[model samples]
Target chain A: MINVLVGSTVLPGNLEAVLEIYRELVARTRNEPGCVSYELLQLREDPCDLMLLECWLSQEHLDAHTRTPHFVEAIAQLEMLETAAPALIYTKSV
Target chain B: MINVLVGSTVLPGNLEAVLEIYRELVARTRNEPGCVSYELLQLREDPCDLMLLECWLSQEHLDAHTRTPHFVEAIAQLEMLETAAPALIYTKSV
Candidate 1:
């Protein structure tokens, strides 16, 4: 499986906006083929910090996700509200 | 629920040792009370980078886990093999 940890820092006043996008993105992404899990987490220590824990069946599935309409739209919106580019760590089970 | 993302970088030549430590840690931690999930992930881009994805019922449960013998011992051994202190991000579902 392909596990992805996506860490993003929201802009000072854009938390709500970012979350709105995620609500849509996550809901849609979860229904995609090969999606095992797609969860959103907000940091307790730093409210601006958000993380997406995603699991996919394979690299092809993950690649397809990136090109999907929901992903493209959500990412564009997220980029505007985020402090900088999100940090993505692609991983596999140890 | 309390979710934790722990990022650790292993020292060169210590991957096997670190993995050994985690094998014990993950197995023991899974049997602990209030442990919803405990998984280890290794970065695809950087083999030395590892991440722990954990979920618990509450902060109290997580605190208890830190005080457990298995946790303490495993952490001690991990520190010796890791390049630096792990980065812990405590979180809650958004």
Candidate 2:
């Protein structure tokens, strides 16, 4: 499987906003072709952080998704996030 | 957070082979910059499946890693895997 993970720290009072973003991301990915699973997870012990798993059939499909206009727009909107550390990764297992 | 997940089906008699691949992948990635957490996870209920979480700093960092020779070399070795389904993803949560 190919996996994509995006993580962010939630602002003190922005839990609702964080949830909204997560819900939207999940809904958007679930119907995509080759999407085996899309999971939005919060660290059980770390209320301030969240992680998402995007599982797809191949690197090519994933790359295509990342380049879509929707994804580009999402990034633009999230640029104002108040978190300290944010990350995105693309990886394949050995 | 940046998350990279990789998943695969384990071959019927290749348990040791699978473990060796995981060990090496973990060792090679653990020290990389912006790598906050690298986990090799075998599904609790699915003996034939495995998942890995490669949490890193940013999209740029992840993209660079994907372009590295090691990742390419790893791919060549795994091309012979006997799994029915293999997948990859690149995603950013909204």
lDDT of each: 0.84, 0.63
Per-residue lDDT for B1-94 in model 2, tens only?
Answer: 5555566677758766766766776777777777776766554345556666666777677777667676666566665663524333333343
Predicted complexes: DockQ each: 0.65, 0.06
Q: Which numbered prediction scores highest in TM-score against the true structure?
A: 1
Instruction: Assess the local accuracy of residue A73 in candidate 2 as a C-alpha lDDT between 0 and 100.
Output: 65
Work out how many backbone clashes candidate 2 has.
Answer: 11
Q: Which runs in model 1 stand beyond 4 Å of their true positions?
A: A84-87, B84-87
Write down the TM-score of every candidate: 0.92, 0.48
Per-candidate alpha-carbon RMSD to the true structure: 1.7, 14.1
